[model samples]
Target: MTEGSKLLSEMNERSREVFRRVVEGYLSSGEPVGSRTLTRSMSEKVSAATIRNVMQDLEYLGLLDSPHVSAGRVPTQLGLRMFVDGLMEVATVGPDDRAALDATLGSNERDVGTLLDRVGSALSGLTQGASLVLAPKREAPIRHIEFVSLAPDRALVVLVFADGHVENRVFRPPLGQTPSSMREAANFLNAVAEGKTLSDLRGHIAREIAAHRQELDGLAQDLVESGLALWQDAGESYERLIVRGRSNLIGAAEAAELARVRTLFDDLERKRDIVDFLELAEGGDGVRIFIGSENKLFSLSGSSLVVSPYMNADRKIIGAIGVIGPTRLNYGRIVPIVDYTAQLVGRLLSER
Candidate 1:
């Protein structure tokens, strides 16, 4: 076992009980836990003096801290991490919650964006914290591509994926391009780009156009290149991180916690870091927890994230779903909930 686990193992039963009660009490009510408060709750009738001695030992071991000179003690971030990893009893998703998730997320919705929105809302409501989902970076192969002319120099590009999902982008054809050239370009793309992903099509179309440049006029060539490039750009745009229920973070905040909440809000606005953080979960199997000061992204905010990566049919990790809340969050309950939701999202995507 690691040093932390060994330290926990060496704790006497009474000491462990006192420490657990202190952490649980602090988590339940965001306040420091006093020895007298813990004495009344213990089953073995431990004295307040004895509890205070145990708390002092816990503080010396770096598991607890006193915010003020005479105030009660609170669990530090290290203490909370050790409790979550070693001591906490995770709660299973209740039958009612399981049914609610099933009804809400297990619907027949096939649109990925719409499904993510619903998932975020359901998770926020269940956990009473902010929810975030990183959308899949890989896209389905194209089944069809069409171009419709709105004017001599403008058109609409419609992409139909193999999963029956359709996306449209407004296309600005090269100057002096005509309607007939757009139709011809669309027909060529429809024939060659089918059954290929954007990455594959980019390389294949580039080669095909270079070899057959003599067979087409300038406008048609420009339109074909523009259309393919546009589709590739659109695919990149779909790689997004969706956040919901940020207001819930504010609602649960105490006066002193507002500055940290504001910092978290600023961090959310920087999508690059959030995306990078979620991507770290892609290689892991189960739920991953990042406590305050453990990850620099939320260190200043004293926040915690419980994230789990979702997978596709081939067991490839595609995306992640998670909850962001204060360090005092109910981990025993939320860990199982996030794990179950991640599994459900993976299964749904594989089925789709």
Candidate 2:
């Protein structure tokens, strides 16, 4: 048996029952649960004193904690982790929930950034917690490429991908460039952009130019090179990390809890750290849970994160989606919701 199972087996049946009741009660109410409360709900008519002794034993095992000297006990981080990993009965997404997700995410949205933003928002609304969406890097092959002159010096580069997603980037065109030259540049890119990502296209263009194979005027060649360089220089940080529904983190929090929530907000402000943390989820399978203190980002706030990586058609993990909430969140319900949403998102991305 696993260590957790063996440890759990050490407890008598009544102690295990009492431990489950206390955890359930604490998760439901976000408050300490006393033996008196468990005594009333338990099928076995155990005395409050007897239940209290069992609680003390559980506390000694580092699974429970009493905030005040005389107050009831709440599950510690280890206890919460144990409950979630082993005892929690994850609920499947019901028809209503699945339908709601489909309606929210299955729109005709062709823009990846907007779709992912909506995803984060939808998850936050459903979970009543802040949502994190780590979008995949732009890797789809180009389907169409065009250059539209926004001004004499500025031009808009429109790229439509094989997945039906679109991206627009602005770049400064070469001086004295005309509409005809812009058209030539677009033609050159579209001819070779057939099945290459933007980064790949840039390298291909450079090689073609260096080899002196393409017949193009100097101005048009310069425009082509300049536009691709500009886009590349912009890099992948644009909307790569998205966090939504932060206000939910602070909802009705007490003074001390509110302080912790503020700290979490401060942590969220460091998008780089959040991105780094989300990238770790890419290495895991299915839904991954990080409870209080497990992740330093949420350690100060004592928050928890539940995340899962989404995949592409090739079953390759691309990005991650998850929710952040208090340690007392309803894991039994939220775990399945996050898992289903991640799977749905993967299928959607694969189809596109």
- Candidate lDDT scores, in order, read 0.83, 0.83
Candidate 2 local lDDT, 1-352, one digit each (tens) = 6555666878888988888899999889988998878878998899999998899999999889999887599998888888887789999987876777788776898888888888788788888889988887788798998889888888888888898878778778889888888888889888878898876776788877777645887888999878767546364537777899998888846678998998888777766574566565765789989898886667888889998988889988878888899998889888888999889888988888
Clash pairs (backbone) in predicted model 1: none
Give the per-residue lDDT of model 1 (tens digit) for 1-352.
Answer: 7656777999999988988888999889988999888877898988889888999999999999999887499998878988987889999998876776777776777778888888888888888889888877556799998878778767788889897878778867788877777777877787788998776787899888898889777788898988766744353545367888899899889899999999988888766575566665764679988898876667888889888998889998778888999988899988888888888988988887
What lDDT would candidate 2 get against the real structure?
A: 0.83
* Model 1, TM vs. native: 0.77
Model 2, poorest ten-residue lDDT window?
228-237
| Window of ten residues with lowest summed lDDT in model 1 | 231-240
Give all TM-scores, in the order shown: 0.77, 0.75
